[model samples]
Target: MQFLDTINFSVPLLANATETVDSSMVIKSVLLSLVVIYFVSKLGGELSNKVGLPPVLGELLGGVVIGISILHLLVFPEGSTDSSSSLIMNFLQTTAGLTPEATPQVFAAQSEVISVLAELGVIILLFEIGLESNLKELMAVGIQASVVAVVGVVVPFGAGTIGLMTLFGISAVPAIFAGAALTATSIGITSKVLSEIGKLNSKEGQIILGAAVIDDILGIIVLAVVASLAKDGEVDINKVIYLIVSATGFLLGAIVLGNIFNQTFVAIADKLKTRGGLVIPAFIFAFIMAYLAAVIQLEAILGAFAAGLVLEETDKRKELQRQVIPIADMLVPIFFVTVGAKTDLGVLNPTIPSNREGLIMATFLIAVAIIGKVVTGLTVFGQPGINRLAIGIGMIPRGEVGLVFAGVGAASGALSKPLGAAIVMMVILTTFLAPPLLRFVFPDETTTATLEAASGTSLVIESDVITLTDSQENELKS
Candidate 1:
């Protein structure tokens, strides 16, 4: 028998060995990834605090520094072939071993394990986001938030599309992809900013938080629409409508179901008097709801958000939050770092920039990115003493949401390399710009605290303004 035939015939033997080898490698990869994420997050958190910056910025910078491309270059000199051998072999061996005829099944097994772990990272990130959310506060400002979110999404999308079409001479598909990229508002960084400045519960902060929730919902809808359009050469209005309806229904249903379940689960936990007994059930419910949302063409994060909202009415909510947060705190940074790692700076090295037409297109898209959300700040109606400027600055950061759009666009081939590069740059700039501008606009504790008081909100000061430590902020729920 041929060697290939022999290998294929020995599949059962290989499978058993592969499982053992894979289990070990997976453990090693997860441990290594965790260690890297821990040290990077710690260092980033320290640098951000030292410089009066959001810790997320530090985390992202660390990710970029240690990204595959950058690290590859550093570990292997420019003209060296030594590093290529293992890298190529790893990729090929992993791909080949997935089939029946292969010597090393360990590579494929490691890949599967890493993929599962990465997915877990996503789930935990969403859960943390949900836990941090305050549904009552969000509801209070829902109308204003809706208006701001709409304007923020629509204006940038329109501007981005038109700019791309008119100047870059791109088609509607790619233009729409660019527009979709502009719709997300990264609230994690904004939340950190508000916490750092002790204004997380103020009227402006409430508006920002509310608007950001809506922003994420709308952003996902836009992405779904753009993706559908790219595939069929026409927008699937029916799919879009179904997505909206399903998302709305899923959120409402999860809220009602979660409230009912949370009460029952908490009662059981109380009867048992066991620590964290309720968490497993809560997590299971969240995963189930998230799965249902995915089935209906909605993002799982939306369902996770609903799950958090539903748990708000439970008696054991604080205990639940406390128990789950530490796990989330450790795992959430992996999601952010993975996002930064996907960014390829090499896309910026383009030969067409000197083309006047390309330059004009890029300029227009940049303007759209800047102006769209800035205008949304005016949507805070019926409120005086509101710093619309700060609200706009808070809305500026595009962090994870933009990255999601860019990733989808790249996968669908709707975003060209140069355009993707520009979008990434735009996201990074907006994120970095918010904190300093916010500090400038709302300078002191007196002003921020007074604003909070006027809004009938409470402010918790956990640390020095100019010097923040790595401690978590005291949540100021209304």
Candidate 2:
């Protein structure tokens, strides 16, 4: 009995020992990775600005430079990575005296922590975008935006799916999965670029923003249908209908209820007496809203966005916007940089025989990706002189949303290696190229200038230009 008791005690001791190492290594590794993220993001952003490109593009390239395709400094454990492929892992082994036996555990923990931070970064980004967006303008373009979103989804999905089946002799299931991938518009990336170029509130910008939001709803529905088919060989009509109803109700209900919430939100903020009087309550609301959305099977960012739209109606909106900017500046780059890092550009290499076919397939997908989205701009019947071309180009980038489709499809074993690679290639090209093209097509205006331009038709230019009113003149003389 005494010997048996000793054996149990030893096992607990060993387990505790292992846990301690894991906790220590995870902290060390995440800190180092954040240092790399901050340095590269700022450097890349400055250089990008110097060359007149969108800073987001530069931050993305900076991520690629440090990721698996190049320095391997910021590698993740997913895909085909080994201990040897990760610089941080090797550095720990060398300097921190990390035992080879403990490397895998430490590496996984480190990657998981960093990934969570990156996700939080994006959530904050969407929340900030929601604050900046004009809810009234977004609703005014509702019909046109819905039309553009449907066309954006239908055109690419139909073309890509059909083209793969007929041109490449691919099966219907895999083709459908790829088609689903094409349906997503990375609203995060699109909105970021629009904000960068002072186009976020223009008629075209609001339309694109509204359309992108709708596109996300459609993409989620399409994903559920295809994923079901991939598993069980048929669609789930009930589940599909549930998603459609839930999503529509969520949006409409939230906007309608926003008026009531806006007052309560202001009241709560006014009562708070401490340092974070405003921002703290604001974040709590955003995070809770994000959690609620995730609970209802919608994207958490959508919830965060809804939270912003609600809060924007409050009188404190301008002050809240000013407060949110620094927080955004701090966290948002991690999202973009991590997106760039996760992308493996090696699949595009032509010398490898396996990649040769993928490259060819990628070329076809890329053309379809561009043409399919570009045509959505022309679908607007009522909005004349709305910069149809800019709206189309704005919808071009697949960004991280496409990656989710690729990841899910690959995990379901429905995507062949070449087809997966081809999908990834199309996503990479579209994500990188869209920002500059959008900036080129939209006129450069200050935020004030853009607002003025947007309202130019409505402005009444009276003949009393540069003339003071009688009340103003009397006040000035006194």
- Can you give the TM-score per candidate against the true fold? 0.77, 0.90
lDDT of 2 by residue, 11-87 (tens): 12224546544667767877888999999999999899898888999999999999988899888766678767889
The C-alpha stretches of model 2 lying farther than 4 A from their native spots are 1-21, 446-478
Overall lDDT per candidate, in order of appearance: 0.64, 0.84
C-alpha positional error of residue 226 in candidate 1 after TM-score superposition, expressed in Å: 2.1
| Residue 250, candidate 2: C-alpha displacement in angstroms | 1.1
All candidates: CA RMSD in angstroms? 8.3, 8.1
Alpha carbon lDDT of residue 34, candidate 1?
57
